[model samples]
Target: MTYDDLLRRAAALARPGHRAILGIAGSPGAGKTTLARRLVRDLGDIAAHVPMDGFHLADAELDRLGLRDRKGAPETFDAGGYAALLRRLRDERGEVVYAPGFERVLEQPIAGAVPVPPGARLVVTEGNYLLLDTGSWVRVRGELDEVWFCAPDEEDRVRRLVARHEEFGKSHEAAVAWVLRSDQRNAELVAGTRERADLVLTAAQLPEP
Candidate 1:
């Protein structure tokens, strides 16, 4: 429906005692991060944000593996490690856990950038491949209390993606080329996993700024 509905749904998950994880899954530019952050911000101290982008493989590692060109593809991420972190976040309730975070300008992951204190009862994790049922990614869903998919208008999504790349250092042409040649392929793959999500949210369903 609207942001109010999402807020209510998220609030219900952050109950007393046990911790809860709310996963937001979608393709690049579908606004998963935007939605996840908004939920955490609105939910106040009970929620913490842990993004999947934080799990991206370093450029050096990608170069060594000959995957430098396919940076945003699922193969370029530490899927197993991401899954393991999710498991820890879900199980380790009392400690002050830390999670990695990604820097868009540097296109690198920063370790221990996010802190999830014991007071945080909910963790909002957003990513592209959370719903993927392949390889180590299959372990992710088991750790989440609920997963919601974001499916925005295609034209708008592509536009935002291109602008994001351009904002991060790519030229307009390079950004367009990357979005069409690489991101689009990954987007299609993520789209296929939509049916597996507990709920699907569209542009109109997201929060109003």
Candidate 2:
């Protein structure tokens, strides 16, 4: 399917009386965030983007836990907190719900950053572990109305991931090493959950940002 078809399907999930949450799950560099952002932008007022990256554990906390090196791993995030927020979003309690936002430059999560107004009928959330069945990640699937998985070509995904790391201040060599070591492991884990998704998307289905 084309990107337009995906948009139409996502938009159709929003009924007049019910709120829907659409989850975009993929490995690192699979373009989950890009797709979610595009969906929200195209959907406009009826949709809101609430990324799971917002639930990343603080850098200090990561150091305390000794998981700083595995920053993008599932364990590095506050999985329980993320699940709780999704529950709150699903409940639609008629209040403005505030979610954290991750700053790529600072590599920290800003608290109460993204506000989801009560009027929004569709919530688009994207992240790596959304489809994972481990621990608190299992709770995420229940809250989401539908979850779509994205799988681009492995070489392209790795290239994008390396470029992203370099753009965020890592040296080219360091970015390549990080992608091969840290991000690749996380990607493998995420890839195992592809079968659990409601739909699987490919690069052909995505549009350029």
Candidate 3:
């Protein structure tokens, strides 16, 4: 579908009386964040963007758990916290709600970085494990009105992932290694949950990378 098509569908979810939460799920580098931001930007004040990356555990905590090497894995995030935030966004309690945001430079989650005002009728959230049906992740799907999966070409996805790592200070060789090892594993796991999404989209339907 085109971006305009997606925008119309998102707008439809916020029909007459209720607020809605729309989720964008995909493997690493599949453009979930890009699509979520585009939806929010196109919809303007009616929507808000709340990313799941904000729930990533701090680097020091990852080090303490010996999970620093597998940073983007599902286990590395605060899944329960993410679920709670989604619940709050769904509630739309007539007050502003704060959500965390990830800082690429620091590679950490910054608290209270995103604000969802009371007037927003839609909350656009994107993440890797939104359709994952294990442990704390099971609570996620129940909180979202619908989840869209993004599936980009595998080669392009890998290239984008490697470039992102390099952009954040990793050497080219290290970036490739990480993408092939850690990121690829997570990507494969996320792919398994694709069938559960309400809709599936491709990179072509999103903004140019």
Candidate 4:
């Protein structure tokens, strides 16, 4: 289906008195963030964007645990904290709720950077591990009303992933190496969870807002 078609379906998720959450899952550089931001923008005041990148462990924390090399892996995140935030978004409807945001250049998570107001009927969150059925990650899928997985062309995805790393401060060679060694492994894990998604989307299926 086209972006417009998905927009209509997303809009329909909001009811008179309930809040619904839509999850966008995909491998690194699959355009999950782009699609999610566009959908929330098109849906206007009814929607809010809450990206899962916000749960990334700080560099200091990663260093302490000696997991810095596995930065993008599922273990590098505060999965339980993310799950709790999702649960709060689903149940605490009376007041404004704040979710964390990540800074790409610094590669750090900023706390209380995103606000989900009471008026927001739908929350659109995107991430790589949304569909993972392991450990604390398992709690993620249960909170989302429907999860959509992005499946872009492999070559295109790799190109974008490499470019992103470079844009955020890595050298060309370093970016490519990181993409192939680290990102690729995480991508494979995320790909395995695609079948569990309610819908699968391609880059062509998503349009600019």
Which parts of model 3 have CA positions greater than 4 angstroms off?
none
Estimate the Cα RMSD of every predicted model relative to the unseen true structure. 0.9, 0.9, 1.0, 1.1
- The deviation in Å at residue 81 for candidate 1 is 0.8
**Candidate 2 structure quality by residue, lDDT tens digits, 1-209:** 88889989998998887789999999999998889989999999999999999999999999999999999999999999998998888786498999999999999999999999988999999999998888999998889989999999888899999999999999999999999999999999999999999999888886653
Model 3, residue 72: C-alpha shift (Å): 0.6
lDDT of 4 at 129: 98
User: Cα lDDT for residue 128, model 4?
Assistant: 99
Off by over 4 Å in 4: none
Tens digits of lDDT, candidate 1, 1-209: 88889899999999999799999999999998889889999899999999999999999999999999899899999999998998898889899999999998888999999999988899999999999998889998888999999999999999999989988999999999999999999999999999999999988997533
* C-alpha positional error of residue 24 in candidate 3 after TM-score superposition, expressed in Å: 0.3
- lDDT at residue 159 of model 3 (Cα atoms): 91
TM-score of predicted structure 3: 0.97
Per-residue lDDT over 1-209 for candidate 4, one digit per residue giving the tens place of the 0 to 100 score? 98899999999997769999999999999999999989998899999999999999999999999999999999999999999999999999989999999999889999999999999999999999999999999999899999999999888899989989999999999999999999999999999999999999887896532
Model 4 TM-score, all chains together: 0.98
Q: Where does candidate 1 clash, by residue pair?
A: none
